[model samples]
Target: MCNNQLTITNPRYLKYARITGNPVHVYSGRDDYRLRVPCGHCDDCLKRRQQQWFSRAHHLMKRMALRPDQCLFCTFTLKPSVYEQAKEKPYIPIRQFLDRLRKHPRFREKDPITKRYRYRKVKFPYLFVVEFADGKTAAKRGRVSTHRMHYHAILFGCPLYWWQVRDLWQGDVVDEAKGWYTGMGKAEVDPLESESGVRYVLKYMTKDCAAHQYISDVDARKNGKLIVSHGFGRLSKEDIKIMRKNMLRGASSWFCHFINNYRYSIPRYWKTACFSPNEIRCRNDSLIPGILRDFVKKRYPFPDFTFQQQQQIYNCLLWP
Candidate 1:
């Protein structure tokens, strides 16, 4: 596996993790700490990993025309997971997150509310299957078992929506949500597997995911700028909340309201304020400078709330 930021081929999707020389994570699945390899790696790269990768979702991952006795990896025999040996990760209760997601204006599940009148789907799906390398390199090069089911539907007035299925074995309880119309191809070029079919095959191979922690400290002004550059003028409250909680650097409660709500068609918001950041070195073309200019152009187009309101808005340490 190339540890120097190389790709044998670009990943089919935008977000597969890199294969590495270092063992970076811990999982109950593996007896040892392993380097996480993405499913997109070439056969040569994966062969180097010496792993027995399997998935219960799309059988294609294991459907090569090989003898049953043929070794799965380096002549090692395939030992299918029995209920006895497989260690199931604790299930994440989806109720709360699902509830929160449903409340979003964008929430659209394929049910009666959506089936009759919903017209279209999202331009982009939010569900992602992030792969990471698994196992030691010098000692034992390895590939991550890959697959995570992604869902899409336009059945409701909510219209476009997507979600990911992290565990398929739990489907006995989630059969409704697990609904799928398989056999459709994802790409025109594939025979037994079209792009969608290949994607369907890949959805079953999820390696244990621990990468969510890595996203906990994402830069906001930088992230937000990317969104703005894409031409979106406003942000959701959740975005502002993520900003204020320090997940985003330099997030202020006041700025949160203006940045998250005020649309960009109005240029008076940050047209002339200080474009430079005092703390985190904001990213390139960070519209923050432009935004500050807009704010300045509007004479700091901000609220001058009553003292009581101000006190309630800002924490004591931030009282200004």
Candidate 2:
């Protein structure tokens, strides 16, 4: 587990609390002040990111009205020599390859009637993850152990044949005897048969690679240029808002606060007001102040508070 919990001690939160007449009670134990910051390198942070990506991709698939048959799972790789040349900065070649592939004549063809080159009418929304695999496992299968970097992608509204993609990726180097292009590298495409395929491709977003063999895969993601798309653009602001709203509904305050303000230190107000380790000793409803009760009721109306839970409600509103 990542022991990178950041402590929240911002004075602004204290000022806000004082201004609101809810002066935060400073806890004596230092452990109570800890905040879980979502550092991207940690497993927990990566898992959350994976879930977020899955949600966004699933929502995008539905928004595009695409069926499983309309989607294709594709893989693209570079030649061993090419990988060796750019091993330290793998994202450079990956970006260059994707850019060239997108601008290839097959993907963007000139209209016969207008003689104008235009992208295809169908929407092409894609999500891809660049993966680096040190092929030590290949030894069991009688294969050489080598470093392999490749892309796993889920492309929507694809209309081309597998060989067409190969030809495009390999720069049309045709092997006349083999009836297919044997060019620089490999390209494999298969129909996405079910919803599970979406999860399958997105799974690579959190896939871990051995740190000893090469650089961390997370470093490649930090470059933020591996994405390739044609007709469909990125998710709109409204779409993201809707997805976040849906995800945060009925969620805990700690989780909601962390996600809403990721990579930042948690506010002192959240630590003091939203969560506590001490058990409530007072349970009398009449003991709660009318103003505090109304505020808590207005903010959280879903849960039916029982006699035993009244103390918890009061603690959340006016932390002791």
Candidate 3:
């Protein structure tokens, strides 16, 4: 079972907890008080990780100012023979291939000062989730059928056309047996048409099967990386502070409750509410009323009300 609560001992984090309602703890720490490392199979931990990833992706999209047209959803697969060679550590070769592809001359321009090739203006922030599929045909043949590894990625600021990307991905491998050129198994590239498309790409990180497969790999399991990313750069202390503020502003009441109760010692208020018969509501119920009314009034300016009537309406809505 996953330990849902953690004890706060660090002075820095304790201070943070006092100021903000958040309980901060070191993830995967080996200390006696800290919870055991996540197994990646526990439902509670999995859900928490999914939410963390969603928030991270949301933050990255906003920070980069990425538009739908600037993003591409891409899938990359490896040939059966290639996978067979590195079955134990498939991600190693795939990571190497991605590094090479990113540095390909097609996406580079010569610097006027140094006359050296440099990547184009596009920063090319990208996220990749590795997934596996079973080969039914190979299983039927009585051969040891291993899981085939592939990647689904959300790429930003990639200027290449789908076909062009496909061609570049195929590379210049010549298949002697077939008497023609071949590349990797297959590649698919499609433009993101809307924000939903980005979410669709991020959804792969939450799939139970995908998580299981990634955890099955010895290297990836040891590292505990559910997804691979590049070019976004590191987050500084200031950036983290800003992100936390943004998260609090946009978070739902349930999320706030979770954050506030994340410690081993549950607060008295939540404990009382938990035992109460009546359904518990958010502490500050009035927080959303004004925003909701303004949105409703702006979208559907229904039967206009006078000052006195508006006051009555507000009173009725705010009634406990």
Candidates in order, TM-scores: namely 0.17, 0.55, 0.53
lDDT of prediction 3 = 0.56
**Tens digit of per-residue lDDT, candidate 1, span 1-320:** 33332322223211222343323332224322233344533443333221121111112222322222221110001112321121121112122223333444444445576465332333211111222212233234345432211222111111222222211112223234544222111111112222233233233232222222222232111110100012112324553344345323432322322322431111212211212344324432354455444444354334655545544444321221
lDDT, residue 166, candidate 1: 19
Q: Rank the candidates by lDDT, best first.
A: 2, 3, 1
Q: Please give the TM-score that candidate 1 achieves against the real structure.
A: 0.17
* Clashing residue pairs for model 3: none
Model 1, position 64: C-alpha lDDT score = 29
Higher-scoring candidate on lDDT, 2 or 3: 2
Best by lDDT: 2
Taken over the whole model, the C-alpha lDDT of each candidate is: 0.26, 0.57, 0.56
C-alpha RMSD for every candidate: 23.3, 11.4, 13.3
Q: What 10-residue stretch in candidate 2 is worst by lDDT? A: 277-286
Write candidate 3's Cα lDDT for 219-306 as tens digits: 3442223445652434555664553454346425322323223412222333343333222234335356765566546644556756
